[model samples]
Target: MAAIEPEATGFEPESAVRKMSGFSLKPAERRALLTILCALLAVRILAMFWYPFVDSTEARYAEIARKMLETGDWITPQFDYGVPFWGKPPLHTWMSALGMKIFGVSHFGARFLFLIASLGLLAVCYVWVRKLRGHDLALVAIAVMASAGLFYGASAFVVTDMAMVLGTTMSMAGFYACLADKSSHRVWGYLFFAGLAVGLLAKGPVAVVLTGIPIFLWVVIGNRWRQLLRLPWITGTLLTGLIALPWYLLAEAKTPGFLNYFIIGEHYKRFLETGWQGDLYGSAHARAKGMIWVYGFIAFLPWVLFAPALATRGRQVLEIFRKDRTGWHSYLLAWTLSPLILFTPAANILPAYVLPGIPAAAILLVSVWAGIFGQPGRKTRAWVAVSMIGVAVVVFGLTTVAFFFPNTLNVRSERELVQKALETSPDIAINYWGDRSYSAEFYTQGRLRYIADSATLEALKSNDVRDALAVYSHDIPRLKDRLEAGFVDLGRFNRRHLFVEPPLQ
Candidate 1:
């Protein structure tokens, strides 16, 4: 497992960046590029503060991290007060907790690490692609990634997909570096393994499957199987084990049977079984198999629309695939297709499942365009500059509007209802009936309570908690009737009603 000098990965050294690449940008283009970057940066910062925390997903993760911060238990992710969450590893929660510690427990703090991971992923893409392709193509790819709808949205959200993408992309890029530059073998080899470790922490075996399988398949197809021996697998494996295993082992030791649920129930059955009955924490989506393929286009929106333009380069792309000895096309194809292939037969699917491969798709799209068009001429540069500025403007305006707009979309109604309850009775206990809102828990600092049934509501009616706040849907006839009798109607938000008991004294 010693670091052996690996054979060429079919990449050629790129030349110095030219004027069109923005390395030494022309006056107008430089101003334009600077404006675009500044605009994007401003919008991202504004989004951090302006956007509402989404329910069921974003708020769930933020609450778990908040709970971790609250209870001082960093090992097991807590779904409720004492309920252990085995849905994902603690890496994401741990990162957010650290963010909360630094920035205070708030929405921005919860998503801070995710935003950093997204930016780091982009930086990695820029450096890696710049080394393989010329500066112009690298910049194009980076621009496309930054402007892509899903990538842009995922960048600001508190989700595991961005962290997962960071790990997988880092691992793959490191491998590419090892193959592309023999002199950098030790550095890139170690990076590859380090990323593998990160990926494991990010999403468990699925990371290995998504990343390792693609590299393995590409090597086999390219007849470069022997290159595997050249990698520092022994050291790499040890490093990965050191970083990823201790958490899993410690979590299992703390909570017996965690490993069983996480690995088998979450990883296996959740994917293979439609409406998976084994899921202990939540129900499965059970979308038709291969829906991920369709989601790919949606996730790659605005850019995927350019597929027709890219289609004209089919002969060029095919030739690159058939003739390129550097394995560039092969590696990209593998990277892009790996997740789609793996998830194609799965019962449950989400756009985030295809996230790790998005960077690859963007890179591939730009590379094909670069291959066909060669360097950008004056007209092309002007168009590129305009497009970059225009997209940035649109994204900034869209985010601004989304922020100022009311939560009429119903997306934030649950949060609004919870807020209303809190506003109604700050001194009394604020609770919900019928269901729970994790977002509410996050906003209330985990003080929100749930009244499960009529029995609980009846018991609470006479309890010393005079003028307590409660939130429930008006459609729940039983709960509604009981609420009206004991609690004065305060107000309404969306379909949920806010009530204050004892007629507010």
Candidate 2:
């Protein structure tokens, strides 16, 4: 990891705080680094196009967006038609649905907006790091962040967390820019609240909590309380409300009990209660308290592997937090640690929750790397670049493997199964015996339904449409003798057995 010593120097013109940094990269070296970063990004985009949306999480959201698109109800994202989904706001779904409108509802269409959002967050962080350090350091930061475990995995995956990450990044970047600028700070000040609005819309109140943590800690620890007044508070709150409040209000009006379920049940009970049973749409993801820190370690990988780079310059790293007037280093530390700290006590968490902190962690790591290995020679710099490139290549390789052998990776998508079922019963309404698959809904365009009982199955059949049953091998015995005797089994697709109406003897 140390072979390619990263090049960086602190550039805090607002307070003139500088870090002890390493040698600058030559033009050829910089170009090489840039080329690698761009290539890796292209690979990430290709992964998005090549891979199918896996079952449950990715396909669930994609199905919800597809439903939203079909229903023309822009106000609420439905878990199923007539069932309003209050788990999250419509920001990610809105964009994904818009992407589907323009591109058609395919893997690329459903996932394209997420890639745009992830790259947009990277862009914001890249510019912020460039202002604090130079081109080389910024390059190191984005390279580390973009290839990190959770960030890379979620780059184009259809999840709500990416939009929230973008919100947190924008807020963190705009806040620091406001601190750094010598004049004309009003625009940046408004940007801080604009980020708040985005975050609120993207996830919920948690976005505000994520952004506020670092700012509060930096202000209190640095005793820089007077800086708060410089920002435009009165108008900013109004702007945030204008953008985010209407949706909350409108959702509650459209569907009663939405606000109560979403705000209190989702944000409050779900966080503090393990195995929280209040979830209306899906089961809660519960982990042990403080598990978020462990997830943080996993999510920040490849960069987390380089902790010794920062530890080697422990004194300089500590001194920046204690002595730097611009609050940049301390701010980065606070920003990177904020999500981990906040979710440490929460019983429900996922690895993607760690994403908001990763960009700051990468920037901070590269800054310390530069501080420790001052003027690392050309050979050492090349080694550092190779180390980073190797990690990224490994990530791309994993994606390639997933593209080729999804089943090997335990990737669950009902696309092929649905397609195979259609060939067997072209006009038959395919139904599951029990339990629904979101990927089936997405692949079949919301036509897939589950048989709650014999009555529903008979009712589907009475519509003069032959209703085929796709039952799991294990679940085949659960059906009545009529179904088991009256149907022709049409072979297995994955674990499920598709059955069509019996042939006349």
> Which prediction has the highest lDDT against the true structure?
2
lDDT of 1 at 245: 94
Q: What is residue 435's positional error in candidate 1, in angstroms? A: 1.4
lDDT of 2 by residue, 336-391 (tens): 99999899999988888888898888888777667666555676566667766776
Ten contiguous residues minimizing lDDT sum, candidate 1: 1-10
> What RMSD, rounded to one decimal, does every model reach?
3.4, 4.7
Using all chains and alpha carbons, the TM-scores for the candidates as numbered come to 0.91, 0.90
Model 2: runs farther than 4 Å from truth? 1-23, 320-323, 375-404, 454-466, 479-484, 502-505
Superposed model 1: Cα runs more than 4 Å off: 1-31, 377-403, 466-476, 502-505
Q: What is the lDDT of residue 141 in candidate 1?
A: 81
True lDDT of residue 298, candidate 1: 82
lDDT per residue for candidate 1 within 279-374, as digits (tens), equals 766678789999999988888876787688667878877875665567776788799988899999999878888887889999987776666666
Candidate topping TM-score? 1
